[model samples]
Target chain A: MKLVPLADRVVLKQLEAEETTKSGIILTSSAQEKPQEAEIVAVGPGGVIDGKEVKMNVEVGQKVIYSRYAGSEVKLDGKEYIVVRQNDILAIVED
Target chain B: MKLVPLADRVVLKQLEAEETTKSGIILTSSAQEKPQEAEIVAVGPGGVIDGKEVKMNVEVGQKVIYSRYAGSEVKLDGKEYIVVRQNDILAIVED
Candidate 1:
């Protein structure tokens, strides 16, 4: 099963955050910073929000950055995903 | 001094958070949820970010909602401001 966002929400899959330092010792989970980067798995259809015309600019399969501590966490089919509004998406990454 | 957001950055002044309960007792700062609503003070001239062209839809003097735990904190002239990318803005509040 996949997530489909409604309104301006988007579902993202977290990218692997480097847990090891140059010395190759893995840091404890509590010592590591929260991951902020993700790959867009699904995007919501943009529409009117608070009577304002809102549009979605990000597309599926795009790599995006967001605030590390933001967004609601969801666990689906044993996979973790983040659900956030369009505005929480900082930027779309590109080559 | 006023803040000028470069690129898609936005400067916002946080709204007052209610710390008192119905019993008229005040809660500690740590007990209060992080402010997620703000008034747009200055908006960046949105342009290309991460090779994607972005546009600013929120205008000055507009109330907006954002991720509570996100954004970089800035203090200027005895006032506090939050600087976030345009995408970090969740929604524009209506009248």
Candidate 2:
């Protein structure tokens, strides 16, 4: 099943952290702080919140940075996704 | 010293958590999930991001809700604040 966010939330797939440094030494997962970078998979339709219309700004396929401890990690169809509110996103990673 | 956020960051002073129940039973700080509500203090002048100008939508003195684990807890002048990017704010509380 595909992960989808409701309300002002977004579903993001975690981008894999670098496994090696410039020298090419493969580091284990334990050596990395869990990467907070993610690719947006889906976003909730903007809803009226507190009498104001909150609009969805980011689009699918956009990369974003989020607070390290922001969202709940979930697995769907063997893939990992983070479900977090749009505001939990720190910045859109322009590439 | 006051806290000022650079770029799209915002300085927020956390609102107090409730310490009692309807029956007038007092609850300890440990018993409450750390409150995620805050009052905006200073907002960064929205800079050119993604080649698009992101304007400030919320103003100072507005109350907001944030992701529970999003911002870094900071203290200035004996008062507590949270430093987070604008995206880390979920919604403005209309009062």
Candidate 3:
């Protein structure tokens, strides 16, 4: 099931956990920890302002850094998804 | 201690719980229940756009309805505060 955002909303998939431990302590997903990073999957065609359409600044496939506590967590088809506004995106990751 | 947001940020204080029961169940703050409404306390001078300053659309003392899961909760001076972008505000409540 493909997820699509409506009206300036963006869909993000949480990044997979790192294989190595940050402090020599390997952790598993079952630990109930939330990932701080995510990949932008889909974005809505900008929101309307005074009858004008404002395009989104971020693009698909961009790795973004957002506030750890931002956005709503939704489980769709057994997969976790986050829905946040473009403004919630703090910075785009560059590699 | 007053909180002043920076760069289009908005500070909000959660509304206190209703004294009565919602569904014949008395729920307290200790139940870990998150509030769905808040009052806007401070707003940052809007974020820069093309070097132009865009004033915040919302005003102080406005009751805003935000996503139940949006924003980061912060504890400062023993008071709870939420920091969210102006865009995270879904709607304004009218009395």
Candidate 4:
């Protein structure tokens, strides 16, 4: 089953460690650090959350940087994803 | 200087650990668990944050239960306080 995030939550697919890492050296998946970069796999509908009106700014397929300590890790369909509130996202990664 | 929260931020004064623990046994301050309960010391004006409109639902002197891992601790004038977003607060505790 696919993950459908609730209000103000976005589903993110973490970018491959080697792809985002600035360091030329490549590390195995298990050895890679917790990269803060990720791609928006699924965007949640922004609505009233905790009495706050949230508007989703990032669309699916956008690369973004998220807070290191934010979000919950979920393994679905053998793929790992992180579900975080829109506020947890710090910025949109530009080309 | 007094802490003035900005944009839906709330400054909370953590209740003494000994007062919150229900266990008949008493523990030293250093050994007490991270109490999730606190009293609201100051409230921020509701406004736009990250493109979302937030309204503060809490008031000063109200006891509330907040998320365990939420907010940042600040030391002001030798008094410790926690600064957290309004959403971090889970519920109000009424005696």
TM-scores for every candidate against the unseen true structure: 0.47, 0.46, 0.43, 0.46
- Tell me the tens digit of each residue's lDDT in model 1 across B1-95: 78889988899988665511221222111121232556899999987777666766778897665555558989999999999887677555443
Which ten contiguous residues of candidate 3 chain A have the minimum total lDDT?
A22-31
Quality of candidate 3's docking, in CAPRI categories?
Answer: incorrect
Relative to the unseen true structure, what is the C-alpha lDDT of residue B75 in candidate 4, on a scale of 0 to 100?
43
Top-TM-score candidate index? 1
The fraction of reference interface contacts (C-alpha pairs within 8 A across chains A and B) present in each candidate is 0.00, 0.00, 0.02, 0.02
Q: Please, what are the lDDT tens digits per residue for candidate 2 over residues B56-95?
A: 7878998887754436554333455566668778788774
In candidate 4, stretches whose alpha carbon ends up further than 4 angstroms from where it belongs are A22-35, B1-47, B50-95
**What is the per-residue lDDT of model 3 for residues A17-60, given as tens digits with 9 covering 90 to 100?**
65112212121121222224468989988757435555577789
Q: What value does DockQ give for candidate 1?
A: 0.02
Candidate 1 lDDT: 0.66
In TM-score terms, candidate 4 sits at 0.46
Which regions of candidate 3 fall more than 4 Å away from where they truly are? A19-35, A49-53, A68-70, B1-95
Off by over 4 Å in 1: A1-7, A10-95, B18-35
Question: Rank order by DockQ, top first?
Answer: 3, 2, 4, 1
Q: Specify the poorest-scoring 10-residue window by lDDT in model 3 chain B.
A: B19-28
lDDT of 3 at A37: 48
RMSD of each: 12.3, 12.4, 11.5, 11.7
| Per-residue lDDT over A14-75 for candidate 4, one digit per residue giving the tens place of the 0 to 100 score | 87866655522221111111225678899889887777677777689987655546589999
